[model samples]
Target chain A: MAQGNFILREKEYLALQASLKKLLANSYAKVVFLVDKNGSLIASAGATGDFDTTSLASLTAGNIAATGGLASLIGEKEFSILFHEGERDNMHISVVANRIILVVIFDRRSSVGLVRLRVRRTATELERILRDIDAGAGKEEEGDFEELTEADIESLLK
Target chain B: MSFINYSSREINCKIVYYGPGLCGKTTNLQYIYRRTNPESRGKMISLTTDTERTLFFDFLPLSLGEVRGFKTRFHLYTVPGQVFYDASRRLILRGVDGVVFSADSQLTRMDANVESLENLQVNLREQGYDSDRIPLVMQYNKRDLPHVASVAELHALLNYRNVPEFEAVATTGVGVFETLKAIIKLILIDLKKGGR
Candidate 1:
């Protein structure tokens, strides 16, 4: 067990990977990434080298969290989706299962309408998989994690 | 929450530096970002105001080698410490694996320190994390200041559970890594216990 553990077992991982891949195929987005509400990168598929995916995941969670705050201020239950459009890139972020967030980054090649349409279909499937994953993970998320050698942890320091 | 990427062989943990406004929470992250090798650290991002006050948070992504085959990545963040930013503070604590309360050592700021500590507990509770059980550390910062609270006094007010505490002059880097290591060590121990 590491800190902030969000365990996705093999079954869940495959399902998430497949869902992401499917989303990318059906949509015109450059990347389809999934992030936990805590800003942890769950699964990110498609090309994502324009920016660090890890950083993107963290900031996305923060963005969603901040937006949730704004929603509270406005007396809304929650803002389930966020859209940020840039000159060169556009992003669509949707809250999935109230626990995870799905982000679709697109370029001029795609329209928000198409992305939203595909996302609407994929989101329901993603949510179903997520519920199953949570139920399956239980408390044994890292039950098989072996104790690490000293050299292993020390290597990161260097 | 810790995100495990078996495919990438990585484990990501979030640790938040929390305290009253201007309590050197951001300073600690800047020191760490400065000291860490660029290869092992991501770009430090600060969401700040025109006055450079941390408007949202200061994030520094650090990769501290690996455990077993998994790279241990720690995302260190500092909440907007001003009291008025309570909403943002609670948001930052959502998946916190550990906390470092950077209490200002100035006697005049004692009230702010105490308030921030209480706020941390309340915020953590809102996120379903027990402050007592979480891996938490305290750093009495700005110890070099002329008028500062005594370690005993600060401890009495802040370290209610008597967790590992340190004296820090964050500007000069004193006691920064020591406090960080203490909390990281605690987090690793908890992780070994399956994060119970």
Candidate 2:
């Protein structure tokens, strides 16, 4: 597998959920999400029912990718954090573990300072969990696809 | 790269459409988006300029049913094909699991096709992906045009890997789904090989 590929087992999923939950509580944010740089939603917490998380994940990844490109042109490695303030809501996006994106959506109830402080602590925890997931993926020999056959794959598309 | 979520029994993969300016990469995606069942497709987003040219990229999420009790989802993206958008194109290729090189079949655009194909290889290398190793499908689009190159010529020019190739007219939906299915199958096959 390529270096950025990963499998999220139940153990790491639960840990990620807990950390995101804590961050949402501490910062009084409406929602928090853990998305891969490729725009896959790993986990999310808080009020998520109103928004379409799949689109959010894809757009957030695009935003980060574009920002990373601009940073490179200006002779920087990457812009680690991005904040977008809307009239009624605000978004706090950060890069965690160099491969995952941490997103927090908050309203006037949560200030950027509070969110940033809480995110700093949660980012470290998330990074540790992501590293563990990578390590686990590396230690495994075979994947669930070992039992997958060509017929099975073809049938799905059909 | 693909993401396997055991917790959700889901597999998510990213596939990119690459080609030169005005080569119908976005048209291919639009055809699929319109033909797909509403339940199996999500919102399609296109970041385009005032003249309707792709500014950054276009994104569409799709569900390809389930395999072995695990649902398969594909995120399709089209990069800006203009020459100056190289920076933006490179950004969209990050973590891509498969690619569909949409080559313009017009005889005059042959040089553009070769240049874009070479650019694809270079960008893939920069992203730590070997173009030869990645799951790729060739799409020779605009075949219905008056002045077009032969499929043999297009293949000779762009199909160095001799991968599965399709002749498409994206506007009228000819060969759109065929091209998409070929790439999806290749990606799944690669995944079955432990993503090697």
Candidate 3:
């Protein structure tokens, strides 16, 4: 991938993590995994604890991709959320925009129903955020990268 | 007519095994990997975190028989069945073709199963897919374990809509192929009807 594409993807990744943190607020989740459209782990939140978010993010992307295909087969358009229940914990996976995914893990304390409901609303919000970011990127193309001084890159590094 | 033109007339479709954490979603994939012919499948890749939990995803691409001059391909994936990973799950669901809802058939897990199913519905809807219309198959996995709920009981709670459902013991490979074949069939049949 070109440096420009890499930078954009990285930016998209960071944005997704920030968005996930905001959505998971008050949810009491242990960890949050964010993946790209191709099922690559872009970012994660909460405790590293005992789980691996990178692998989980990739797998989650693969799962959703397959699920989306399945949805199309049945004459549907896309896939939104997938939930799995366990004795001690539960998993909630939701699709955000067309390029990112959100994975939430919670225990008995949190209600799966509540998470599911919250996820639906968050998906819509995340979509809007992504659209805004894309628009901003477009606007920046007009003398954007050319205008950035060495100071800007240095500040970003800081 | 050859619909997919990129590859060797091989129609590669993705299938996701989704369920709650530890509900045998991974088990289903493991069983398939163990039993499938090596020549027909690619190397199984599982990405994990520092502690070795599935972080990004698990991928296993399998080659099934040809259909209408297309070599049937199925890439199976399992989400990090943990709750906090919703973002990752959403990303993985892009361009999916079929799904296997691996439910833990334990009496104690009844509520979780219901909640998970509903979550599936909501997630599918967000991606513009109606849960009722997707090519979905249900697998009540972990039947070998004691204290697990019976098939009938699970059906009563999770199968209210009456989609294709199967009883599975993922650890022993029981119902694994049945579940896989069922979903694959659904995808192929769907393609034939939709003219995709």
Candidate 4:
């Protein structure tokens, strides 16, 4: 039917929500949330009900993509931080395991200083968690080139 | 004569629309097709299953105006989002210059979004394209639905790193162009920076 269809299992959602809640509690930011690389809403806490997380997710992914490209221009291997600040609200974006993006949205209710402080530690932990998932997925081993049957190729070509 | 003809004025880049199954990935392409001028777009091709779901891929070629005397053409593709179709997704992602991730907006689709996003990363890594370094854009589709999660909630769960994210309703073409423009602009700028 529809393309890019994603169905979130309850267990994963609970875990994501719990992790987000925990992350938010550690910071004074009035709003703390998360969105997928495709701009889908996963789990969030604080000021989340007010905005379109899906739209924000799309924008966040775009931001990371641009920054990552910028990183390469500088001869860097990867891009990490996409942090920005405004007069009233500040945003910080980081890449975690190259899979999911970790975003922190804070306002004057929480200083940019505090968001940055929490982001540093949270990003590391998020990376580790994603790494664990990767290890468990059994696709971690390199060079997984499956020989394609002619039928398979034909099917794709069609 | 060069076999590949890379020195030609026209530069072609591949952009893939990737995500989990039924996440409105195809809808994004369809909306783009409907809105684009017939002269500016090629015939839309879809390889689908017996049930008519896109079993393999969807392809659309678009001309994104001209730059520096060379026409910039983008071949947009969407991989089958089903979990079992990982191989196909990988194959499609190869040689891609940019990506637009079309995430489903429903609350229940959260895990699938995360899993598919991870899949994109793994596949990209396997192909020697670092996901973190590629020009990627995110689109949370189906924003017109009522059961969708709030943007704050989504940001907390999916956007811990705060990437360029967008809100879209693919069926109606809302925010689709914005998403495409953002990724294309990013890719073009990257090429310019690389002196390509």
Q: Could you give the interface RMSD of each candidate, to one decimal?
A: 3.4, 1.4, 19.1, 19.1
Model 2 CAPRI quality: medium
lDDT score, residue A37, model 3?
Answer: 60
Q: Rate the local accuracy (lDDT) of all candidates.
A: 0.86, 0.92, 0.68, 0.67
Put down candidate 2 lDDT per residue, A1-158, tens digits, no spaces: 34645688888899999999999999999999989999989999998998889999999999999999889889999999999999999999999978899999999998999999999999999989978887887445346787789899779878
Better of 1 and 2 by lDDT: 2
Per-residue lDDT, model 1, residue B50, is 100
**Which candidate wins on DockQ?**
2
Per-residue lDDT of candidate 3, residues B74-180 (tens digit): 77888777777776666555556777898988878877788777877777777666577667999998787789887888888888778799988888888988888
Q: What is the docking quality class of candidate 3?
A: incorrect
Which digits, one per residue and each the tens of the lDDT, describe model 1 over residues A59-141? 99999999999998999979998999999999999998888899999999989999999999999999899788667664553
Runs with alpha carbons beyond 4 Å of true place in candidate 4: A1-158, B1-8
**TM-score per model over all chains:** 0.93, 0.97, 0.56, 0.54
| TM-score quality measure for candidate 3 | 0.56
Candidate 4: docking tier? incorrect
Tens-place lDDT per residue, model 4, B46-153, is 778998688767777776655544455677878899999776676666557788888888999999889988888889888777678777888888899989988777
| Candidate 3 local lDDT, A5-85, one digit each (tens) | 211334554666676786567577777776556544445678755774544655676677768777887998887878889
Candidate 1 lDDT, tens digit per residue, B60-177? 9888876776778898999999999899999998888889999999999999999999998888888888778888999999999999999999999989999999999999999999
Q: Which one is best on lDDT? A: 2
